[model samples]
Target: MFKKPLHTLKTSAPLRSSDRRKLKQRVIDAFTLDPELGDALVPEGILTIKFNTHLDEPGVAYLSPEASADPLWFSLGKGSEELIPSVYTLWKRPDLLPFLSTPPAVIPILVGGADLMIPGVVHHPSDLKEGQLVAVCQYTHRSKNGATLSVPLAVGRMAVAGDRIQDGEKGKAVFVLHVWKDFLWDMGGKPQDMPEQRPLAALVDQPESEAAEGDEEIPVDKLTITAQPAYTPAEISTLLQASLLQALSTKIPASAFPLSASVFYETYILLFRPAFPHSVLPPGAGTENSSDIGPGNPQNITIKSSAHKSLTAFLKAMDKAGLLTSKTAPKQNELLVTAVVDERHPSVAAHRGFVTLGEVEARAAKKAVNEEKKREKEEEGGRRVEVRELCKASGRTIGWVEGVGGSPKTLYEPTELRTLLNAYITDKGLVNPREQAYVNVGLDPLLLGAVVTPPKKGVPQKEVEFMKRDEVMKGLLDGMQAWYEVRVGGREVVLKKGALKPIRVEVKMRQGRKACTLVSGFEAFGEGVVDAEEMSEELRKICAGATSVSPRVGGPTGTVEVLVQGKQAKVVVDYLTEKRGVPKKWVEVVDLVGGKK
Candidate 1:
């Protein structure tokens, strides 16, 4: 079983031109023998870089293609100057396959991020020493011939010498850095399954023919020196029984009553002929001249007529043995199966039980639940909770109110209300075509009186155009009643916002024990024609401190806020309203200059 990764990741500053050059140089030096691998992994079009401090040495991830949000290469430093590929990178790039090798049974455990056990390793060169980069592969057998060994499951790692692995040590043989389907693989979005493994030396030398050259035709004589004995009747029977059970579990559903044996055999059972060819295949199965049947289609490997006759006979035999109930045709070409083979059937009782459709479904369901639980635990540290808050203007629909810093769910600050109003206007298409900056109240009467105050005694206009955007936003918020959203576990209740405090500027302690001021309601100020970067820079200079902008997960783009250094809440609010032209009504000083709001 796999355990959740303990390390957390945060977005780091984008690499400058100078830093990119330095990173490329380091990669080139580390992979001196394989220059193309170094280039493909850390391409020039990288978008972002993230740092992981959890490992023995710090890890750096390089994302590329300028548009992709996920990293293509995750590199870990063995010491100061040398670097090795992480397991994640190896899964995607098979060109590095010459480095490491392992056996088949160790693949699942490696995908779960477990260390490679010494006992499971089949082969590695004696020249392979500790601290070298390597690739791990499963000793897979050819699909058509089990005697010929092939390497299909490829992973990457730091190397440990063969002598050390043979020391009978109980610890890990290879320290697994990453794996397929782990948290890092799923970081930006759903990752595709790792590519099928290819020959190690060929992939390293010829990149273009890797896919076409995956399977090599090896003669059976080369696979074994001694002649093999023919399978006995009992062995053939066991193989057929296992194949029958597998086909039943995968193709038949519990609710599919009175199934047709002819359709089942044609679709499901025939597909297994390649796996159990010697036991399940009908006599002279592939001897037919099926070339005239169709174009671009290979000859039928299993003769349909013979397979149908044999399948009907097999079903009837099972029915007589009381494994299932079946109705057979006179020509033995079809059968109607009624019920599944009961688990308590005497014939299969010794082999645990007959596998019914219900049992197969239960096992599938259990697997889904375990995967969901694992994903939830991986995201446990950062939870996105939405609160139901009534829009002061349109109380008919509940608006989503999200948590900021540490605050109770009540009342919408003027800035937060502004974001909601803009969203409503966009959603309703209420903007006048003639005047893009003005709202067209004719689309919805509620948006007129509720969203903005009625025209004043001397005013003649009735829409958003007459007033500034801030004035219209303020008027709408003042006209509506406040509401509160209370949440407990999975249940949420909404009530009127009575005597609830508004939003404010709060200072929080971040990494390195630095005090940073968090301004929550500035979301609306960054929208439309507003310049977020210019505003952030101004705040930094005004407060004489460093500043950064971080978007709240699952929150609107309008809610992306700024973080300023030290205790500058009071100063920030004054600057926002007076210097930046934000209205004072939209700015609230709910918290003290140096404390929590």
Candidate 2:
């Protein structure tokens, strides 16, 4: 169903703590998962995406937990909200979902948006029922070290019931929905490596070719040459141990020791691990590239194998061996690759060298620097808000507005439009004599069009037309083109279609008599107009109280909320208009606490 781009109906901010806990509990119940594994499967925060599928069916998916992840789960059809773990989620814990294995030749067909037929199924769980969700993969996903990995390539629903498998069947077995390289996978910011595959000739009569049935081979000139080192001994545990010693002795210097364990592992260990060649090769961007898999080109490796269970365990083992010092950091208890590397240790001194180790270390150092810069850039950058701009002044509204030298092309701020309407009403002497706050709607032709409907045909008016001044003003503005202006430092971007959102300033009671003022909706004005941290610091000084800025959950995406101690709604409003030059009309002040602020 997600073979095409789904139209997003709405997207929610991160789930609140209470809601998140409830979701976790629900997952544990549905998947029959252990509490710890279930918790790890769910991210700290999830973005709820409600969308319309290709078939117009409503669907939802939970996206990235932190920042650099993919959609965690999605569901469609009758069980729309029944979260189905995405390929990304399944990669970490493939046992969480039931899967059907097909021959390797059939995988290329499934990746091309084809549903899995009953003939293609080589293996499936006995407990599977019709309409049950399943991961689609191949038997050839076996690693070189003689381990079969349950890596999923696509997700789909079972068309045939599990109980009816004894009887010979044909047609669709799994109704293919989402594929590995489909648009949904592209939502994630991080790139993923496709699992390796090998030919399996056991499925319903098909050729043993790598490409799908009836597929043509491309010209030799079109193929990119990917050269790589031939497969050596496939014992991963041994390779990892050797790579760890090499990385510590060569890549990480004595001065660089005592580093965060995660940093050292990410920067050094992974880069130095021996590469394992496979039939389905990963892109050799940072490593070496050639058409043939031979000597001189050191390829990449995998951490998903069973040999490596956890980094902490591996580091501790090395520490026990007296080759390095690994200990929990003070206070935080985080593992630290300490500054006590045994350079003269037997393992370090007797380590053999590889041809591309130097090239690999250089790349790793460059990558670490680049990643740090990227992280800083992401933190420093702010979010932008986009709203629709509505209709503009035209026809009768323009004709009357032209008397004041206004033109059809002129763009006025919302406040300016309200002021202009009030001036027109006052100039025409249309105020109700009996009520100071009321305006006689029938007193002017423009008011008749804007605020009053003319008598239908021969119908007579039953009562004198009148409306509250604010209501009358609202009618006039509605007839004219709607406008919302954004003031971002010294620049402005006036878009069309969406109504403007005001800067919301609200005050609420906290601990007994204590109160705090909350500010939001600054995205409409842009970050340049008011940096959250800067505004918080400014408020701290002006109000002589504590203030802070933080990202707001359950609101707009990427919204940063500002908070100040005490009931400072009035002060916040004044500061916005006076100091930031935010229009008076764009500041919405609400005081839940009784009395004036």
Candidate 3:
């Protein structure tokens, strides 16, 4: 079964150019429909085709399933997408509408840029080829608040795609697809599926209205031809010079300008000029040896020589030129030599580098003398230690001690008592030096017992002196007792008594019962016992002092030891005056001094 090759339907001559132009305009109009799409078309601008289905598959058939369609791919102009939206809108025109709905699934041929292939086309238009440069109109996609639209921009091209489709009329409609050669392989569709076609130079070339004067409209060959704007030679030269200056300025100094072989030669030529000859002798001077004058006003000169010969030549030249000058030069008889001394040598201490023997001997002698003095000081210190020990043992101050034969332990050992005494003396300044010495010698004054005299044997035990009532009264009268009285009038009174009656007194001596009680009575008008006995001794003494004394007695209550007319008498009375309790008064009987009553 021989199958006929598929062929593209050709459009009639009247429809070829006009229908193609309408389709191109429709593509450009698609961009203006959306601003975001328009912005996308601007930078590195691109012609994008978002197919309803995967581009690898055949396009949808408009009327019959037998029809075939495929993918196409191309580029918009470089950095331009303006032509796409306008051209895409033209695809809906009456003349081009048939192609869109054709049974063969009319694949749109976007003149500016495209991304799909049309079936049944072999070669592109005769005026276009691959790698031929072209301009493009591209639509960009944009989204705002959920709505998406397209906008168009213009761009230039680097290469072209090779694919075509007929316009189904007389003259075959040519499809020009622009592309970047660098991106040809990854156009997202296979070459077989999305057949690409190069754009015609005539289509992208300057418009007829912009054609230069006297320029003829000539048909171009299938080989790609590009016409670029002519560049000004003067502007190019200026740019080149600026580039060279920038490069050189970065490397060379201003002082290195006007570089040329002639300038190099001329600079060296000045060095050899007789007017400025190069010489070791300074500017105003002639030959170095021409100094016919003496050691005054020396000419300036700079000599160049190798390291090994520089010094030697300098001295030789100075001599030959008669320029040797010095305030005091060395005499021929003087000898010069280098010498080194070792610091570890014994003699080295006396002489640093160079010195006279006299100086060396003097220093050595001085050192020896210092050593002897040091030894003497050490011996003296040893002797002083022995003397100090002797002082300690002998209990003497340092000055009192003599000699050096004493135990060293004795120097620090102090008698226990003496150590305590000394510590006390130091802390409290010696109150009594004699007492301090006594304490140091192990004796305390307060600890000594008092001396006693023994009593004579055979003597009757001496009677204990008892205080009689009279004697107690006499003592009270002598102001030895304290007596106070509370009178009936509420006034307090005090008195001294010369005598008091004795009373029976009992003092309990038992543990927890140490108290004294007395019972006594006093006669009043020879009747009942006077209440005076019941009163305290203090009140009795006060009353007795104020009352007249009458010698009245009563039995048992009154008993007296009396001396009448110098004779001793004992009188007993039924009534008596008695005293009890603590004695609050004293009585005194002083010898009469020439009084007779």
Candidate 4:
């Protein structure tokens, strides 16, 4: 009875096939339905799958028997020595067995470790560390009918977290695995074969050292450190070409790649054509075709051959543009001369007085001729004569009887008398002694008397004549009128009516219009005339002052004497003389007849 109970308990507890399948389907659903579940199941030695459930709950289902068989027996969680389970062989679910039974078309593995081989990878059971596990998926090109063709290249997980692939060493081969399907399949029934591995063949195969070494290592000492080359017109053309190439090859999404290259080329041509013909490449290898030199390699050329023409052209242009200057001889001398006048010696009237006088003598001779003609007729009938005489007398008187006595005068030699007269006339006009007498001579008695008398003592005679009262008044009025005119017309006035005061009676000198003041006792008389009379009177007075006497001798015995009185006045007369005949007297004074009696 005890054996039967134990057996019954064991057999009765065993899971049914449907329930096991359901559990397996649930696990597969967990990996396929939830994207994150695939990442978590990778380390758990489990695979997830998705299923269409007839049941209400649609969720993760697990199949332990399939997950624990064969390669799974390695117990990756404990690191046991057993064959590891391939990720493709993991069961997705029990109930979804038919859908997941086929192995994946390709096993995805990260390329890593020694020599960057695919085998050195972390798969199911080991945790997928960063840069470890990756899945490569086939890339497909779709046709218009929805048919798909495999591409030579594959899309892979990058060396990043979550969907990461490992980075290989330098110069080591590396690859990433990409999966085409989204879901995992159940590992049931017969085991599936791994997919074919398609490796990428290298193009331009070269050793790492050789590719790096191909670049010329210019020894610093041997290499020329040229000045940075300036981009000239030609140089810029190459740069523009490079830019255009870069713009054309720039990655455009597949959707936009359909745009034709011709259109892009035309656009570039239109945009750069104006400057392209004149552009040049900067100095360097393959500068002439720099646009064609890709990032890979460049051709070599000499510095002179690379855009030197453009540079030379630019230098010539700079010279023509007057960007350079040099020292040169001056075109003209800097010194100059200027003329100026001497202001201090300007010409004036006084400077003209020193001119030659030949013209003055010519004028005098002409006047003499005119005067001789005027006197020619008067002198035609007159005979010229000369005379000399002498007389001496004495007188005495008593109280009752007056007695007089006289002596007969002897005649003087006429030669001595004539000689004395000629000498006197030459020196001081003429002279006649009281004892000698001459008549019909060109002399006046008043003039002779004036010369004979000694000047009175203590008397001051005026050099200039003075004006009388009426003349003074006239002059003053005229002066006042002139002052008024000048004052009214000029900028300033210097005189007033009351500026002068009278000191004495006014007297006019006959010789000039000037006037002088006389003392109270002194008297002066002349014509008293009104304005018109005054002018005529003044004229007559002028004429009288200028008159001279001419004597006539009818019978030689007759005598005449003229007395002219003035303030130190004198008179002159003209006489006619017979040639070789003698006259008794030519000049005599009656007042001196008795000889100072």
In terms of TM-score, which candidate is strongest?
Answer: 1
Candidate 1 vs candidate 3, lDDT winner: 1
Give the winner by lDDT: 2
Clashing pairs in 1: 99-135, 100-135
- What TM-score does candidate 3 reach? 0.13
Which digits, one per residue and each the tens of the lDDT, describe model 1 over residues 147-183? 1223323344444564565423434456565655565
Residue lDDT tens for model 3, 1-597: 001111111221122444334434444364323333222222121222321111111111011011111112122323333342122222111111111111111122231133222222222333434444332322111111111111111112223343323322222222233222212212222223322221222323436774453223333343221111222322222222222222222233334533332232122211121211111112223434333211111000111111112323333332243322212125643221111123332333332222222232233334333443453445333222110001122222211112222242333322332343345434434234544323221122211110011137976543322333233223222322222221111212222222233332222222353322222322211111123322333333443322122233353535321111210001111112122112212211222222211
Per-model TM-score versus the true fold: 0.36, 0.34, 0.13, 0.15
Residues 321-404, candidate 4, lDDT per residue (tens digit)?
332112222453221111111222222111212111112223223333333334333332221222112211111101101111
RMSD of each: 23.0, 18.0, 61.1, 67.7
The lDDT for every candidate, in the order shown, is 0.49, 0.62, 0.24, 0.25
TM-score winner, 1 or 4:
1
How do all the candidates rank in terms of lDDT, highest first?
2, 1, 4, 3
Instruction: Supply the global lDDT for candidate 3.
Output: 0.24
What tens-digit string does per-residue lDDT give for candidate 2 at 1-597? 555455445755787778777778878888887778667877677677667653346777777766754877877765645778777777776556566775555665665556776645655655578999888876542233322333787888888786444324645678877877776777775465654442322222235483354223333332111234433323334555666776666645678777887787666765565432232223333332222222322222333332455667777877887777888978998999886455476788887654333353354334434443453344233212233344467554665667655777887665676777678778888888889898877666655665443468889855547789888656656666665555332235444445777888988897898899999987766544556876887899999999988887578788889999998898998888766666677788888887433
| Superposed Cα deviation of residue 270, candidate 1 (Å) | 14
Q: After superposition, how far is residue 40 of candidate 2 from its true place, in Å?
A: 1.1
